[model samples]
Target: MAADDLPDEVPADPALSASADPAPSIELLAGPLEIVDRITIASNATFVGRIGETEVVYKPIMGEQPLWDFPDGDLGHREAAAYLVSEAFGWDIVPRTWLRDGPLGVGMVQLWQDVDPAQDAVDIKPVAAVPGEGWRLVFEGYDDRDRPVALVHEDSAELRRMAVFDVVVNNADRKGGHILEMPGGHRHGIDHGLTFHEDHKLRTVLWGWAGEPLLPDELARIEAVRQDLDAALGETLTAYITVTELVALADRCEHLLQSAAFPHPRGRTPATPYPLF
Candidate 1:
């Protein structure tokens, strides 16, 4: 792609945000950024930095680990695009993310969420110890100790919306580590690099509602996306994704509206990611 074909380097102005609230963090991201430390938990090279008084996470395009499955572009663009998709939902599923030039190079910078240490949104428990309520079981399996365990996540509206968001984006990886549990009971989905595939690659742990009908509110939100795919949303997406991908996104939105339910895993049959942390 030519440099002229590239998307705008920054996000839309704060005045035009879906939240309808002004935020200075977006400006800080495009301005001076100072790295404080490297985050060793992620597969790619990640860093925590300060933009004025705001804290953010930075993932440089150069640090992306190339995969045979995702060859079209680097992960940074996907991160920005994911933010755009989440913004379209107006669900606040994703954090404030945008692309900008950093110390190393151009990368994705996102506002950091302060997590509540006592909370565990997604967790594994001994099979017998799994709670009877407040959680939905994904599957039952054995642990490293060969003891029976159950993989479960909170059964809440927040997680359900995130599950729907994952479906629309064709997210290939929605590991336990990517779900951030914030203080006010709001959960934000992170690490969206492996998303928006043209094919069905929705690998996530929040499939407890598989094959179930979407609620009226859920359907309304999806319809809005489907209706706007050919308008502003589609135009903004073209900056990051290909024409093929944009079409696929529209198809996914239509499919969900037609099916009106959470889709079951297709080819692989419950295609879950490896090292399921």
Candidate 2:
């Protein structure tokens, strides 16, 4: 991928720099994807590649495992839908993601986030550690060695936005590793193939703000997304999620606006994804 091929400003989490994005829309999304390698940790056929100079993660529909709940070969659409919702909230919390035909088949391609290795939004610490002054505890348990440990995340407005984003999307998987800690403290969530189900399936390590009143800005974001649902946003997502799920997405936003608070974890499903990291 040649750096000089595109324009100046880029979209969310440009893999490299301004050279990667001047006008970031078309070339990146509609690309001749070259596969550098597979992202082995991902469950699906995931790869790292580029349209030009920009780096991206690609998940082919053909590689998705059958889910008892979701329709097959459409995980890419759900991921794109999640990106749309994140953009609607005016928070680039999901990174830039879109659907396109890739080297394998149709899939979701997203800009690779360059996370700061020194930062960890969510962490597990020894239960006896005392310096949790600004962190939120999700739960406590024992590690594999039968040692006591605590599941925790930083208590901050940035992470709070991500938590709200998860609730609105009914994100079924918000594992600790999914929360990418960007250089500037902006936490971006990925792997949304499990999102936007018609049913409530909010699972995460971010239960710290349960029942807390929503901040004014948080309410505004939710309200804005609600208003857009029946309009452009709804229309765009129709190509991705089912109509029922789209309506359910709207309903979730409205519920948040009406309650004006973060929700408590309540569901038959496990409240957190497995292999938390």
Candidate 3:
């Protein structure tokens, strides 16, 4: 779809905005749920629903279609693990995601985020040559009518932080649509089911910072995550993924700390996903 044709931004549900503590929101996620809409384009069965008064996205395991590259029926757990990593770093990139038993069966439920319609930070088309400022050219391609096109994205601090997080998690599918821009300029990332694989698989659109030195704060966050891995992150992820994957996660942290630079594509697979958006 053209960027201009994107759906209107859904306003944040009032129920979640009422409290800052988040305990009430957690309760709502666990409370009785009712489906309000089904999202048909997703590879798996996904729906938008209300839990009590809060809005959320639910992805049931029973709805998953098997992928030869990923283990079957475990995408929901991976989504939750992504949230856990985001929480550990205090990045708040991924939405509040958790595992629960839904009407369809066990699944992952995440708080629905309302994006800012005015901003096109995640996905935008340039009218001419790539903008000289605040954007990075990802690749050049052809549109449907055989026209030359350049794919680029925002070069903002929030997106840079998310790029760091993606490297740590080995996120295999960081599509353009996965990045959400909230009303107050905050960005939230979602759709993390294709992440945390034991092997390296960090395909993404936020390669603007690739090869750049890590900022001091970014380096500090990496160290903090490394320190907490064995105690908190390790324990939390084991329930969802294998121990080997957990070790791989720690190794990724250490490698990034040593390198202190945004990584270039490994070339083992396509650096970017099939559908850039």
| TM-score of every candidate | 0.92, 0.90, 0.89
Q: Which ten residues in a row have the lowest lDDT in candidate 3?
A: 6-15
| Whole-model lDDT, model 2 | 0.82
User: Candidate 3, TM-score vs. the true structure?
Assistant: 0.89
Residue 188 lDDT in model 1? 97
Q: Using lDDT as the measure, what is the rank order of every candidate, best first?
A: 1, 2, 3
Weakest lDDT window of 10 consecutive positions for candidate 2: 6-15
In the order shown, the candidates' Cα RMSDs to the true structure are: 3.2, 5.3, 8.2
Cα lDDT for residue 21, candidate 1:
48
For every model in order, what is the number of clashing pairs? 0, 4, 0
lDDT per residue for candidate 3 within 126-209, as digits (tens), equals: 447668688887777777877777778888888999999999999999998889988887889999988888888899998888
TM-score of 2: 0.90
lDDT of 2 at 57: 92
Candidate 1 runs further than 4 Å off:
1-20
Q: Tens-digit lDDT track for model 1 on 161-184?
A: 999999999999998888999998
Summed over model 2, clashes come to 4
- All candidates in order of TM-score, best leading: 1, 2, 3
**Candidate 1, poorest ten consecutive residues by summed lDDT:** 1-10
